[model samples]
Target: MTEIPLEHVHVAPDEESGGEPAPAVFVLHGRGADEEDLLPVAAELPDELHVVSLRAPDPLQGGYTWYELDLSAGGLESSQPDADDFRRSLDLIGESVERAVDAYGLDADRLGLLGFSQGAITSLSLLLEDPDRYAWVVALHGYLAESHADLDPDGIEGKPVFVGAGAGDRVIPESRTTAAVERFETLDADVASGSFPGGHGIGPQELDAVVEFVASRTA
Candidate 1:
């Protein structure tokens, strides 16, 4: 894979005096959102963990986007025109993940990825493409992109994954979420799936569950 540079901002624990190597969590925001959008969620997590939010390479109208979208279908279209671009974008993310792990002195086996919307799709793709890269993955209000069925489940065996979506999410239908959950299960991932009452947005209950899962895995 080609090397991809990342622009990141770190959030350290409030109590840490200095120079402590805390476990790190990489946060990826949804389409048209920047790294700073999800930084606040880090506060909801355990204070001991470090949070790093990454910005996507491609800049959209105002913010950033993972890949091109097919708004008509509410899904990603993988044609020749967009296929290679998407793959390369994912590769960039993978490289960024490796960099974060090394830069933060995080345990390779304890690294985590948390994403929302398009960011969630990218997160799941990375885990599926390179299984065992993250100890835990939280995909909020996102679906597995095209060609996920062809992934080798053995790669992610025993990895913990939390998938949360709103029951009325229009951007990502519940059926897509169901398919993603089933696919992760088939891949032998320790998957937990839940739905909230709102639409295409994160709620407190969902965030709490994700925080607990990350703490349990890293602790």
Candidate 2:
């Protein structure tokens, strides 16, 4: 597959990568957000993890986006993705992570994905495509994109999957976010799900859960 180039900011652990390859988490941001948007969240994660925040290939209103949503297809709550764009992004993102493993001395087996909003959607889709590639996932305020692939319970079984939702999220809808828990459960993933009392953005409680989830998996 021809991989599209991406811009990113990588934050490495304080310790050197000598005896063992460093564990890394690829951070993906929401629509209209840049790589720098989630730096704070990355900073809060375990120091042992090399945090790599990737800018979406496609530039948007002063930021970036993985794909475009066809709101006209239905509405906000039921919008459809530009299938071509989503597929291209899926391939490109996976390629980027693989390249990073070689470039930054990342442990390919210990890689994780932490994404919010559209990033969350992309993360879940990535996990479904190849569960073995990722050690764990933290998908916040996003729903599963069915167009990506068929749900494979066997492939997803026993993987650490954290599905987060904002109780008052209007952008993705609380129902949609909650639906992901069921989807992951049906796949028999070791799933941890919760809802925060907020809108489309991450709340304090959610942040704690995210940090906790990552820490547990990293150890």
Candidate 3:
């Protein structure tokens, strides 16, 4: 667990208010994006969600990256995260979720993770490392971390997981996307995956599907 509280977290309050505790969706932005990047998508989600977006630890070219990447040999590969950085990120995200739950008075049973690209990679890493920590996971245009090999998908048994991929995603090839889906399935994650007709980014149709999936989980 993270000893220090997560700093630079961006928050968007629940759209609806009652006395009851609401669900929370922690958003993770893609590489070169800031904490506020995914707030729009979060707003489009269920109004009951307390949307919280986190800034990644590593600083890059005027933006932030959860970990370093290397595209040297033909495809994407993780370069910065060794075993330690990987564990630190998982702990940081886990503790951040806990903090958000306590601070927002959010529903622990309904906590979810949403991310794009590098953010999606982190979301998957965090979820796989501590499967019981999150209720649902949504990964868009992202892959499993190359350095992360220890997986216990049984921990996430019966949990809903959505993965969105672009058919023509040049940045992350189709093979990687297939591998991600396979890995999740191997762990027995309730996987819902879709391939859109675009590249490296979420389209309207994909977003609509994600909204429906998340709504079902949050409902």
Q: Who wins the lDDT comparison? A: 2
lDDT of 3 by residue, 1-219 (tens): 233365555454546656677878888888888888777788788877788888888788888877665545444533334456556767877887787777777788778999998888888888877778789999998888766645775577767899989999887765676788888887788999999989988889999999999998988
Evaluated at residue 195, the lDDT of candidate 2 is 84
- Model 3: worst 10 consecutive residues (lDDT sum): 73-82
Give a tens-digit lDDT track for model 2, residues 95-206: 8899888888889999999999999999999998899899999999999886753668346899999989988888998788777888888778999999889899987899
- TM agreement with the true structure for every prediction: 0.88, 0.95, 0.88
Q: Which candidate tops TM-score?
A: 2
Candidate 3 backbone collisions, by pair: none
**Candidate structures ordered by lDDT, highest first:** 2, 3, 1
Instruction: Flag regions of model 2 displaced more than 4 Å.
Output: 1-4
What is the Cα-based lDDT of residue 55 in candidate 2?
91
lDDT of 1 by residue, 21-44 (tens): 566778899888898989878778
Error of 3 at 52 (Å): 0.5
After superposition, candidate 1 runs with Cα above 4 Å error: 1-4, 15-21, 70-81
What is every candidate's alpha-carbon RMSD to the true fold? 3.4, 2.3, 2.9
Give Cα distance to truth, residue 180, candidate 1, Å: 0.2
